[model samples]
Target: MDAVSDFDPARYLSDDLLERIRGRAAAVDAGNVFPDDDLAELRAAGYLAILVPRDLGGAGLSLAEASVLQQRLAGAAPATALAINMHLVWTGVAKVLADRGDDALRFVQEGAAAGEVFAFGISEAGNDLVLFGSDTAATPQPDGGYAFTGTKIFTSLAPVWDQLGLHGLDTTSEDAPRLVFGFVPRTDAVRTRDDWDTLGMRGTQSRTTELHDALAPANRVVRRLAPGPNPDPLVFGIFSVFELLLASVYTGIARRALDVAVETAHARTSKKTGRTYSQDPDIRWRIAEMALAYDGMLPQLEVIARAIDERADHGALWFAKLSGLKHRAVTSAKRVVDEAMLVAGGSSYFTRSELSRLYRDVLAGQFHPSDPESAHSTVAAAWLGPVDPA
Candidate 1:
């Protein structure tokens, strides 16, 4: 079989860099601390600008390339990849808009090139409405700026993000129900809580945020659209970048777990058979199953990413496709990790083992947006039509 070749993730994330991040993964997980040094190194390497246009002093890579690089990074440190995923989400959205000839988010690209970090603040406590609704209140000012009031949960990069891209419900105007999307800089109105203690992906420092009339200047206010699912370009831009990049991270986790399983199968021997576990039919079959599950995911991810980059239109089916890709990648990755643990024997059960950490880390994929239930509903509606409102 011919190898799939278009973009190599290692080109941006070199082996040496991967090793450096890998060396810190265990410690970060144990300490439940953010990967400060890792972020600095990635910043210095210009990874933060991977999706920014070349004219803006960035690497100018496409979404396909960014997805590949993220998978490679996640294989080494899932938390780092996941945390940085928030920043990349904004940049990727900018690229999507620019490709469609709407450059309203040029500030995001310019800020990224200048080394400014952007964090996502869309997720709210108990607000499964996702992009369709916002619990945060966006009050309009005479100067045209917005003062957003409310709390945001799971605010990744909380400790270090320079600007926050967020959304809120605007109830002040005659329209009265527009979802206002904008960027707010780190200032007195914004506060980050030191409450990031979690079961896994500890390095992300995804803490809770309190906003007391946090201000987004008029120029930074990007979109104000009617709340609900609509064909707005901003919605498409956000969903496409968010889902694809997220899928890439979990896919990398699967790759690493599969590698560990292979190594363990070769090294561990069966007492009665007097041979390596690799030679055992049951063990080999399990490994093959893992391989089969993981192999199917990469091509799906790559195809969707390439479609986004090439500006190909799937029209109404785009949401279902993107959500399905994310749902499948994470579920497959979790399955692969489970099989790997069994193949690696009892040694992998220890907390210090890399596979052990991955076991916990991959579980986080289930909590991300476009989750399994949501993905299934989207897909079913696309094929079978929306259920009648009786």
Candidate 2:
């Protein structure tokens, strides 16, 4: 990886680089293949080390900068951006911990600088409790390590990941229950199934993973806390970084859709009026509406990301804000893509059109963590307290 004195995403993610990535996005999606070239170029440009601290031989960028960079990357190729988000999440979490004076994940920064690819192994089938619950079994060993046995779903970068950062429930200990968080290196014990066929973002290749006695050595065990919401830094770091980065990806999609809309409007002419669609009042209004929705998302992302980077305390409200930002970004991006499809006319209906690919890609955002229901619930709970059980 190339090393730079300062973190400037625009410097690395140039218009030329973006066009190169964008050029391959359609083929990647159609073939459902991982963008090896995109990954190689990004890694070579030093993007993989954006969140690692300067001392650890990384760009040492803040979450705010990372968020902006993710948006730019996503605009070029949402699938690639979404897939890389998993790796960045781990590095972002390490940054979060280090900023709070807990250097437990310092090795993560070191590993990232050394080009170790870390995959997120949190999502599981039928586990809606997200971060508060787990079905994976974490069997404690005599040497303070853990043998994890369970299935992890939507494990992005499955084909290339070197280590998986995952969490599981430890029910064997006398304490009975604790959420065990650790990093499991790829080995024969960990099997990644060749699955991940999807309607959109196919290039992510987020396949299912089966762990049979996967081991996380004692030193790699990062945290063991109660399996529920708490003031734990681990929980905060994961939620904050994951949600922000996820939001950034969708926001980028919206920006790209808006640009497509503008270009299509200017190029297409109305036979009836003998003028470009850009001058059509109705078309202009539609573009404005897309712009209106798209504009609000980035500011919110920047605010929340900067707050996290600055270690600003919002108390319990942080959860609501973070989830809300994600919920809004995805929803708004979907709206922008929808409008752009309309602006692009019949051409966008073709499966090969970039806007069509974007249309499908934006849909996956809703299924990610902090879905609409969960986001509403979180914000409502923050404002009105939990619903009355009675």
lDDT of 1: 0.93
- Index of the highest-lDDT prediction: 1
lDDT of 2 at 17: 92
Residue pairs in clash, model 1: none
**Prediction 2 global C-alpha lDDT:** 0.92
- Candidate 1: residue 20 Cα off by (Å): 0.5
Report lDDT (Cα) of residue 227, candidate 2: 83
- Per-residue accuracy of model 1 over 159-216 as CA lDDT, tens digit each: 9999999999999899988999999999999999999998889999999999999999
Total clashes in model 1, counting residue pairs 3 or more apart in sequence or in different chains: 0
Provide TM-scores for the models.
0.98, 0.97
**What are the lDDT figures for the candidates, one per model?**
0.93, 0.92
